[model samples]
Target: MSRHDFYENIRNSTRLNHFANLVNLAAIDGDIKPIEEKLLKRFSRKFDVSEENYEKILENPASFPVHAINLKTQRLEFLFDLLRIVYVDNKMDEAEEFLIRKYAVGLGFSEEQALVVINKSKKLFENNFSFDFYQHFIESDED
Candidate 1:
């Protein structure tokens, strides 16, 4: 396949299949935090992949099997991953934005497309967590 075809595959993969690898790698030094782990688990279930597979991915970062296993749609996910990582600490910084944007360009998005992908990823993450905030709120009300 052409290089374009190759990368396109990466852009279209399900968030679960490949994103687990991305998230896990970023967390190795303790950055994942609990909330991130929750989201990663959700993605794992969503794609029918297991947490076991996630661990495997962590053991071998260089291969990135998700790219070869199924790529027709994940480069976008990868770009979003960078965006998510930038926001992992709860806010975006210039360095994070620049890194994701530059990486997006390499993955084949124009500025506009890259922005859209980034924005969507942001939105996805914004709503990704399913905390028991409501429960906490109700409990607080009891006080």
Candidate 2:
């Protein structure tokens, strides 16, 4: 395959893995609420996940492997998306928190970093701020 095509395939695979992670989070509480389902559908569209693949992922999200995002910005973006699903019901449960932490580590965060990020993200989401605001706050410490 061409270099460009190879890169595109990797990008697509990463998106699919991210989408599966979101699905896993949404269903972690034992039931996917209507609001959560709506958000998941929107995310699936954004990720360019076809209906068939979407269904397949929903059936068994854990079957997919986590793809580590190399860029810090992209990793934070993925974490933000996961946080959105967690807060969709207007409350964060223990299962959701644990799953998000696991995802954060899978996204290349150290355990300590994941704890800090997840705690800060919970507070930020409580304020109902935009992703831009969250991104700025999370990356503000960078030189």
Candidate 3:
């Protein structure tokens, strides 16, 4: 494989792993709702997760690695993605919050920082900022 292809594979793998982890979190709340399943399917397509790979992930979600994306923008994007997933069904349980907190750390934010980021992201969403528009808010305020 070319170097670019290799890196692309790594990035795709990282996305798939994180996606699976989020699904695992969703399942933790007893049952996976229809909306959650639909969002999961959409995310799988976005991540280029193959049917076989998704099946493997479903079989053993713990096997996937939560590899960090190096760029802050991408990491924040992932955080927002997680927020969207957990809240798509219009519900945010403690289990979902706990899982996102774990992901925040995995995304390179400290425990305290993660809470702040997550809350900010949630508020941004509440204000009708979709993911595409939300990045502008974060990017414009880089310290």
Residues 1-143, candidate 3: write the lDDT tens digits.
99999998877766776788766755655576777666666657655679988777766665664666788888888887667655565556654566677788777777987787766665565444667777776555543
**Candidate 2: residue pairs that collide:** none
* TM-score for each of the candidates: 0.37, 0.59, 0.56
Best by lDDT: 2
Clashing pairs in 3: none
Worst 10 contiguous positions by lDDT, candidate 2: 82-91
The stretch of ten residues in a row with the least summed lDDT in candidate 1 is 134-143
* Cα lDDT, model 1, residue 116: 59
* Candidate 1 lDDT for residue 130: 30
lDDT of 2 by residue, 1-143 (tens): 99999999987886787789778766766777887777678767767899999999988876775777788888898888667755665666765576578779888899988888887787688767777899888866642
lDDT of model number 2: 0.77
**Best of the two (1, 2) by lDDT:** 2
Kindly indicate the candidate among 2 and 3 with the higher TM-score: 2
Error of 2 at 138 (Å): 1.8
Candidate 1 lDDT, 38-135, residue by residue in tens: 65555455445566777765455445532321331456445444444455556655534544554565566667766655554554455444323322
Given candidate 1, what's the lDDT at residue 110?
A: 67
**Best of the two (1, 3) by TM-score:** 3
